[model samples]
Target: MTSPASPYVGRFAPSPSGPLHLGSVVAALASWLDARAHGGRWLVRMEDVDGPRTVPGADQVILAQLAALGMTSDDDVIYQSSRHAVYEAALARLTAMGLIYPCGCTRREIADSAPIHAVSGERPYPGTCRTGLQPGRGPRAWRVRMPAGVHCFEDRWLGRQCQDVAREVGDIVLRRADGQWAYQLAVVIDDADQGVTDIVRGADLLSSTARQQVLGQTLGLPLPRVMHVPLIVDTDGRKLSKQNGAPAVDTQAPLVALQAAWTALGFAPLPDASTAAAFLTQATDAWRLRWHIHPCSA
Candidate 1:
């Protein structure tokens, strides 16, 4: 796991809406262990761009939890709230390329207009405001003019995947009605700027990968390698999340917590270790061997 010229960089980007839960830790551990397995840099990014969703002091609390779990950022952690100007500049560039448009259709209107049987029942934003907003309608959001074609990419863990951004996702919103940056745009820009070579996280984001790849091409930024691990779901078969009332990570017994997270990532119980640090060392070795990591290939 010592790649001198790999320049591999991975990140655990958690939205600071709540504390770290079992699901969140699973994603975090996968990213951290991947970075370690490749002898790369692992970063922690606070996705606090959505002001309304962010909880006060949640970032600090989350950092402390990660530290106690034996994973820490390799460099200064970045917060999305501090990068508004940069996001604005990217929007300007898209605007200049005639790829940005103001949308006035509300979420309800889009959903109602969409075919109910669509994939995941998600309304593909019928492009109502593509040409121009309805007469007398004001701009509630800004969306990108998705190019016509299928955007495809290969996943390290899930094999090949594809999506037609224009037909399947329609024009993606760049700025929300609330005037905050959207995840699709912000995350792509951040990864390119940070020179992140690899992305490892939960499989829930697998669908978004193709759209992100399209956006990367539109922005002329290099796309990062991707690996989406299995998602942690509840008894009802729904993904665990803050909105679904997932429980906070049990940190009192750090080693147990670490092992549980690793197991959630589809690994057997790691070799017995007393401390979180020791467990992580053993886990890294296991991860490297399991993935067949090679210094030059990384």
Candidate 2:
């Protein structure tokens, strides 16, 4: 167990592209439970950097759903849209370090340039603009120059993990051509700014951890301990996501929805709890026990 004096901040960051689904609930519950178990502060961050995708009232809807589930942020909710200046400062710092450059390649250009052996399914940016932009091609986005080497970290659930960002992820975009802050850069800056010490989310984001870790290292920010729970997928084995048409969880019957999320996390449903508050208390207790028994303390 973490000492009371030790800082154990955790966060549940969700995009306002849609309402909270079962997948989102699972992630929220896990982060909430972890914060409770460790006697830490839990926060909610609205990842609405891409303004075009944000639904008008989705942030309030998401907050209401979490409240119905007996989970609330320890502090005021932070929206990514309001933090562009902070992100720009971080970008400026990186730019000053000569770690960033203008990217002139379009999606089609990268796809056409990628070699056949790119098994990662992502069209790795072939460093076409690493040296200088191609003639007549203006800058489309800003990309960070990834250094060559294996970046490794220990996941609380998945254990030891490693990835070569330079080879696999390539020069990732810091800002998209559309003038929106890319997720990779914004999330790193936000987590650090909010003093988030732990990140508990779905396994689908596991691949992104290494890239964020590298970016954090470059920015001299403290890396948060991470735990990626198994994703709740659909019948087709696809992870439930707004993009996949996963329906929003019922806020009106939040306790029942929480039960489903608990079950999805491999825990037996709490039969003794009647209300959302009682259920969350029981769930937090169960999680504390599991955390003590788990091999990775962080």
Clashing pairs in 1: none
lDDT of 2 by residue, 116-164 (tens): 4354546667899999988998889999999899999889989999888
What TM-score would every model get versus the actual structure? 0.95, 0.95
> What's the C-alpha lDDT at position 245 in model 1?
95
Backbone clash count for every predicted candidate, in the order shown: 0, 0
What residue pairs clash in candidate 2, if any at all?
Answer: none
Worst 10 residues of 1 by lDDT: 114-123
Best by TM-score: 1
Relative to the true structure, candidate 1 reaches a TM of: 0.95
